[model samples]
Target: MPATRALVLAAAVICLAAAGWLVLREATDPGLAAHPVPGMGEMNAAELSRDGYLVIPAMLREVYVAFGATEEAVIHDTLAAVAAGPALETLYLDRAGAMAGGGLDGADQEIHEMELLDLASSRDGAMLSVNATWRVLGTVGHAEHMHVRGNVYSAALTLAPTAAGWRITGFELLDVDRSDAGTMVAAPEPAEATGG
Candidate 1:
């Protein structure tokens, strides 16, 4: 009876050891990549931060259009889709609502260029900071016709990965430079110069 009990206890120990090994393997498996953006799962902290920066412009474009259109439901949906945490989503939705409420018949925004300026990451990979330059065309209210408002924005972003995917945890506009859109004039034909 003593021998049988010893054997049973040993078997139980072995089973627990095997289960632990499996869990460890799954946690550290380098090949297990799951990310919505292709090639993102393979990126290290800096690279992930850069990629996260690149994705922001696209997300902003969608939300801007939705808000400009005064589609509250769309704004809520877009914010929820891009931002993961509940607090973050609510904050963005409120901002979007404000933009929509701005005195304008309609507005259109386009991100002309984006460059990742810098990135910092936490040791545990739980947080990231991304600094970037975003050149944008801000088309505000129309007069006779739509006009362009050139804007260069310096943005600082905090990002994290959640169950849904990568999302913006924080946002700050560091600086902005604005300029009036230049007017273009048509060239005169040679026929008028000759008095034809």
Candidate 2:
């Protein structure tokens, strides 16, 4: 009976040591540093912040250059892809305007370049701010002939974290005409000028 008692005490001590080791590991390991909230799963605040910075710009570029018969399809697709919040929808309508019957038929745009200038996030990782630039060639509305214009624009987007992930909450943009600075090169001349 004494030998059996000793064996049980040894097993208990071993179990206690294992539990302590696991606790120490969770305390020290960076991977386990962020304690996930209930229902939040494995994603932590830092991961959410990084993903927010990375994904929002790419999605914005996609929405920007995505042209179709009407703005409806593009708008719907963009909203679906990003799952932007209501505040962002207002900004989208203001910036893209095509949703409000601003696009011409047969109009299409090509994004020549895109760059992320800056990215930042809130302390709680609930919000992210992003600055980016894009170079694009798009049709300019004219009754008789199609006119392709190349332009550069800068944008700032704010993101909010939601159960579905990061979503755009706000946006702003500044457009500059490339032809004015004589920097736009290798682009076809306006069809109206060529009478084509």
Candidate 3:
């Protein structure tokens, strides 16, 4: 009976240790603590703060909406409104032009979910990373009609305070996972990759 009691005590200790390890892992995960952007909700720019959590996500959403638009004027206006510095030039000159030239101008995309993965900020500048899932519901680059429900992208962005407000200065797309019919497809090889 004493041996049986010892075995039970050991089992309980192991279970407790496992539970403690899980708790610690969760506590240390940055994604678990990051803020989730409300889907398709309007964020008041006046309420945005440099040190607060809302600014990065809001600006990212604006960029997303602008890229999804079919009208060049809308894309130009939205990017101009929300971005400045290098980000503005890159988006307008490089990315938007690429989209039009690649036949992505007619595609319709919308971000259905977004998660802030990390953030760091100072008095004058800020940097953040985010993961967003967009629903793609139109043809892409002259391909047949496609509907991708889980097109996930990871991006890093930088922002600075300007007289007009917080303006995004940098944007880099890090990774992409394009989906087909709601199923996650394998990421393409580096040479074949096209990012958002």
* Rank list by lDDT: 3, 1, 2
* lDDT tens digits, residue span 1-196, model 1: 9999999999999999999987786567522333443224434444565565456565556545555554556656666555657536655666665665654444433334434444443323445666667666654433334445666777666666666665666767788777645343333355753789
Please write out the lDDT profile of model 2 over residues 72-176, one tens digit for every residue: 666566564554676457645554675455445554444444555455555333455666565555554434444455666676666555555555666666555
Query: How would you encode candidate 3's per-residue C-alpha lDDT over 1-196 as one tens digit per residue?
Result: 9999999999999999999987886576422222322332332222233333655666666777787777778888888777888888888776567675776746445456666655544332123333333333322323433343645555556654444555666777676666443633444555664552
User: What's model 3's overall lDDT?
Assistant: 0.57
- Count of clashing residue pairs in every prediction: 0, 0, 0
Model 3 error, position 81 (Å): 1.6
How many pairs of residues collide in model 2?
0
Better of 1 and 3 by lDDT: 3
Clashing pairs in 2: none
Q: Which regions of candidate 2 deviate over 4 angstroms?
A: 1-44, 51-53, 65-74, 99-103, 120-122, 133-152, 174-196
TM-score of 3: 0.51
Candidates in order, TM-scores: namely: 0.57, 0.53, 0.51
User: Best by TM-score, which number?
Assistant: 1
